[model samples]
Target: MLSVKKLEAFYGDFQALFGIDFEIGESETVSIIGSNGAGKSTFLKTVCGQLKAAPSAIIFAGEPIGGKPANEIVAKGIAMVPEGRRLFRSLTVEENLLMGGFAKRSGPWNLKRVYQLFPALEEKRNNLSTALSGGQQQMVAIGRALMANPKILICDEVSLGLAPIVVKGIYDALPKITSDGLAVIIVEQDIDTAMRVSDRVYCFMHGRVSLKGRSADLTKNQISDAYFGI
Candidate 1:
């Protein structure tokens, strides 16, 4: 459903992604794993149109969409659960989630569906988003992104600040998401979680995909090598 070909990205002249190429199939969950500077985050930024790319680089549902603005990307059915859970601190929980659906896709995702996804969010819907705990805030973030009913959901470091139990709780919702035929591309630093949750995995090193395969087939040594560029 989404394809990125020879994606080269940069911050001003400081290039970060060097000819990165990858694809995510419809309803599939793919993880991008790498060391700190391997460009995993940059890859997602490029795909989401936060970073400009050549016209032919990012193709979403068949059209060349690289370099388009983030708002335009959402209109085309892509939503990002960004790293650090970049929520609007000033907005209430429900308001944050409502912003997610602003793309207005005609689909099964809505405020009701999101509240159902994270039951804790229901009662606190009217509270200021910053009032929630880290995990609860994470759920709000995910729910907010889901409100878009996006065809593809890109999660960048979904487990940055929570406990293991909280992480498990969020991951437990993945099956339901895939069941809805929404493609998920997760950029994760946690190798164990990434391996456990993904259908396929790509390991980036020095800005290129050094390894890509079904998660079940990659070995510890292979992942270690690809992760650290060993």
Candidate 2:
């Protein structure tokens, strides 16, 4: 479980998030949706320790972990699949996955399990990450994060550049990924997909939480109004 209270972030005084509060429970899937510059990514960065925050701002598994180093955060059981898929061009697919395990945490995810999750990765395990198709590269990114065996997995824009079918395949795997009680936070631009995949949804606008509710309870007009400040 994780809790964020009055979270704020900045880049040299240019603030990006404003008093945002959020929480996730075990095995829960939460989605964050907003337009560009809505601070979705900024909130994630602060959570994963890429950006600094007040010590009391972020409480994970009951302890305050704000402003810790990224590596330390990963060791504390939070892993992120960044927006760009950010795979290592020089490393082979398997090697890139192995990099994620540098934290050396113990859990259900490993090479064999990841391969089972995405059969394509096993077939091209030795190929350079850059050589894979966009979808496959995204698989490698997800697989890489899973390799960390994190309690909380954060995925940013997993469907960004992929084909619809490819995106579907990835989204379809969510049930399996979270079956082990892994909490997931997804930052998505596709509102429909976000609503479909998450139990709860948070809409961000201009660095603040504009609306939040159970995904099924939110009407299209409500989401539209919150999303666009209409």
Candidate 3:
């Protein structure tokens, strides 16, 4: 239930996204795959309101929210699990998760529910956030975002530094997280993970969509062509 149109993002004089057009339907999982500097993260940042854009660029649930502040966006049912698992090291795991609920939106997601989604977090609820492993930390990040009970969840580089098995564990939990008609936009460098978990895939190249289609229908050759801009 989100639409991005003619989305052009810039970093001072250097532009990153080139009129990127994308959409995320209700309860849909959309993956964005691209190499470094392809603007995949840029797109997520723009959608999450970290990178400002024109008011008409991003529409969520039919209203334009492009230039809104990040807090406002989160309040409007969009939450982001940014790259690097930027958790509050000083806070306990539970405290970090509680921060997400500051939005105070009413929904199915809550501390109890998030704990059910990642049972491991329950045991570590009182532990220092920095003490958790990378995967556990990632879980905390995801759980933190879920605490907002968002309609759309944006995950940027969720698998960046975790082990393969750990990444798989994280991806495996996505179905349950999105089961309640939540739209998800995942920015992943791992093509296989992206293709596996997403209903549709969008390959970015040089700050634009080189290919977009059903994940199951997109052959390896087509993905390679789009991925490398061949």
Candidate 4:
């Protein structure tokens, strides 16, 4: 459903991605794993339109969206749960979630459905966003992105500072999301989590994909090799 070909991203001349190629099929969950500075997040950022790519560089649902603006991309059925869970500090939990649907895509995502996914958010819907725990905040981020009712959900680092058990709880929810027919592209540094949750894995090295295959097909040594560019 999504494809990036020969994608090159730069921050004022310091290019972070070099001819990166990746694809995510419908209802597929793909993981991008690599060490810091490997450009995994940059890959997602480019896909989400936070960073622009040259025409023909990125395609989604068979259309060229390389240089499109972020909102335009969201409207085209792609939404991202960005890293750091960048929620509005002043907005209530529910308010943050509501903002997620501002794209107004016609589909199954709604505040009630998001609340159902994270029931805790229902009870504390009115609470301040920053008051929630890290995991809870991550849930809000996920719920907010879901509110867009996207065909492809790109999550950038869903498990950052949360506890192990909390991370597990979040991964456990992916099956439900896929069951609901959402394709997920998760950018994660956690190898164990990537191996467990991803259908396929792509390992990045120096702003390029060095290794890729089904998650079960990737061995520890192979992952290490690609991750370190060894």
User: Which numbered prediction scores highest in lDDT against the true structure?
Assistant: 2
Q: Which stretches of candidate 1 lie over 4 Å from their true place?
A: none
| Per-residue lDDT of candidate 2, residues 24-96 (tens digit) | 9999999999999999999999999999999899999999999999999999999999999999899999999
Instruction: Output the better candidate (3/4) by TM-score.
Output: 3
For residue 197, model 1's alpha carbon misses the true position, in angstroms, by 0.5
RMSD of each: 0.8, 0.6, 0.7, 0.8
Across 104-184, the per-residue lDDT of candidate 3 in tens digits comes to 999999999999999999999999999999999999999999999999999999999899999999999988988899989
Error of 3 at 223 (Å): 0.5
> Which ranges in model 3 have alpha carbons more than 4 Å from their true place?
none
lDDT of 1 by residue, 92-146 (tens): 9999999988878888999888888889999999999999999999999899889
Model 1 residue 61 lDDT score: 88
Worst 10 residues of 2 by lDDT: 159-168
Against the reference, the lDDT scores of all candidates come to 0.92, 0.97, 0.94, 0.91
Measured with C-alpha atoms, the lDDT of residue 172 in candidate 1 is 91
Could you tell me how far off, in angstroms, the CA of residue 218 lies in candidate 1 after the best superposition?
0.5
Error of 1 at 75 (Å): 0.4
Candidate 4's residue-wise lDDT over 1-230, tens digit each?
88889999999989899889899898899999999999988888888888878969998889999989998999999999999999999999999999998988898878877777789999999999999999999999999999999999989999998899999998898988887778999988789999999999999988999999999988999999888878
Per-prediction TM-score: 0.98, 0.99, 0.98, 0.98
